[model samples]
Target chain A: MTPYDIILTVLTTLLALYLISFALYIVRVLKGPTIPDRVLALDSLGYDLAAFMLILSIYLNSPMMAVCALSLALWIYALDIYVAKYLEAKEVGG
Target chain B: MSEMLPVIMAFVAALISIVATWLAVQERDMLIATLFSALQSTCYALIYYLLMAPDIVLVYLPVSVGILPLITIILIKKTERYEE
Candidate 1:
């Protein structure tokens, strides 16, 4: 096989593995019993998604997609912080 | 060979993240799960780097690894409730 073929196969395999992990993270987010647990799962899933986006950019040799990944990572952080603060306030008041 | 190194690193990081997610879900304690979630972020940062996106990694690593964890810990502290 050619070198390109070998590299392509490896990249595809790795991407597939990452996708499976992402699916598992989704299950955790759905099944989490507590709010904190769900938040944690969501946080993990966000990070994984960022990684996945980066990998896709590399696989496709597109630099523009990396910009999207950067923005998404930043957005998720804000969401996580906001949700955590809201949860804390609710817990304190109740 | 050198170009393929990034793919190899990405593969390793992805595997680490998968295992960490599994452990986070299996752990009963929310605090431990949060810690695992933070670990997953670190692995993801490495994966991002492997994908040749230093800019994205820079933004992601600190927020996911630092800010998110601190916020989660604070929420946990205020709640004082571990289980459902």
Candidate 2:
């Protein structure tokens, strides 16, 4: 009825959707037929998690937590780059 | 409902992380196992956030998800991909 209640409902629904996507990502990671499949799924999972954390921070009234979300977003690409380098170079280090 | 949402979210994230840990341990492919471990760490970060610990989440995200996985991938490349 109230505006706060509307916001709560929307956030809860979004969180549920996020959880569902997380489940799907895990399934892909677990049963993926190829290395790239798993890597792609993990990448998506990390991006989704970053968004989820941002929303969660808002819901929890802790703006500081957004920094974690930003850091997570930036760091996830390192995994992608590392995997790509390993797949290509056949040697991982610089 | 408002008061209990955090608890429920934390519980669900914990469950997901547990499953991820099991999958990681059971996986024979080192690369995939490392990815699973990263997923597990992601869930742990969520749980930490839900518990009102942003500080822990900040520390945990880089170490467990970023550095740990990078190190494991390097090790995998140094050795082999499959466990057998």
Candidate 3:
């Protein structure tokens, strides 16, 4: 097979790997005893998903789709910050 | 294999979303349920990317993952943590 096919295979494998982590994150979100644990799991899952989107953009040959990934990462980080502060009682409705 | 990559990703995203939606509904804690809803939205964004809908992804991520959860959490803090 060509290098392109090989790259596709690699990307597909990476997608599967990220999805596995996604599944584990779901489980953690379900079984987590504390509020923070669930939030942390959601944090990692969002970041992993952004990485997956980046890889997918490359595989699909759409450089514009990476814009979605970038925005997702940024917004999720903002959510994390808001949640963290909310947890700390620093902000009430952030 | 290359041609089928998008199709495969779409299928997987669908499956994950189904499970995520169910998990969100079943969760007892409002926080965990909100997190699962975020996960469900993330899966939908991936589906949009797979389906070549960049505009939707741009809007969906910030609205669902960012704003929605923050609003929900604030509501939760004012109310109760555990669902009853």
Candidate 4:
């Protein structure tokens, strides 16, 4: 096999493992007992997904996927901040 | 083969972050989980750089590494719900 093929194989294997972890994170998000727990899982999922997209770009030799990563990063930050603020308000109201 | 090492490193780092994320989920304390989340973000930033997206790395590193954790920590402190 060519060196590129070997590299691609290894990278794909790692990506598969990441996808499994991503699925596990989804389970945690669903089963989380608290809002923060769900948010945390969601945050991790976003980051992992961004990484996945970036890796896929490398594998596909496309630069456009990096923009997807950038967007994910921006959206996740906003979502996490909003969730934290909402949780704070809930706690204060109690 | 040598030229592809950076990609390999990036993949391994992503793997590490995934394992860390798994551990974070298993943690019973929210604060610790949040810390892991931050670490996961840092790893992702490295992966972004490795993928030749320095622009994305620059934009996200600060937001994920700086802002998100600060907000989460503040919320945790305010609510006093560090433990699950």
* Candidate closest to the true structure, highest DockQ: 2
Worst 10 residues of 4 chain B by lDDT: B1-10
Q: Model 4, A1-94: lDDT tens per residue?
A: 8999899889867866876796688667656777678778878877787787788778767775567577667767766776566567668984
Q: Quick one: ranking by DockQ, best first?
A: 2, 3, 1, 4
Colliding pairs, model 1: none
TM-score, model 2, chain B versus true chain B: 0.97
lDDT accuracy of residue B77 in candidate 2: 78
Cα lDDT listed for each candidate: 0.71, 0.85, 0.81, 0.72
**Superposition error at A15 for model 2 (Å):** 1.9
lDDT of 3 by residue, A26-77 (tens): 7786678887787788788878878888888787788887888789888878
Give the DockQ (C-alpha) for candidate 2. 0.76
- Per candidate, chain B TM-score? 0.88, 0.97, 0.96, 0.90
lDDT (Cα, tens digit) per residue for candidate 1, span A1-94: 9998888779888977886786687567656777677667777777677777777777777776576567557756765675567567777974
Question: Could you give the C-alpha RMSD of every candidate to the true structure, in order shown?
Answer: 10.5, 2.2, 2.8, 10.9
Global CA lDDT computed for model 1: 0.71
TM-score between model 4 and native = 0.52
lDDT of 2 by residue, A22-85 (tens): 8888789878999899889988988988888889888877788788888888888888998898
lDDT of 4 at B10: 80
Per-model DockQ: 0.05, 0.76, 0.68, 0.05
Q: List pairs with backbone clashes in candidate 3.
A: none
lDDT by residue for model 1 over B1-84, one digit each (tens)? 646656775786688789878988887777667767865776687677666666777677668866777777777767764676
lDDT of 2 by residue, B1-84 (tens): 777888988898898889889988998888888888888888888888888888898899889988998899889878889987
Q: Per-residue lDDT of B30-67 in model 4, one digit per residue for the tens? A: 76677567657767876876677768776877787668
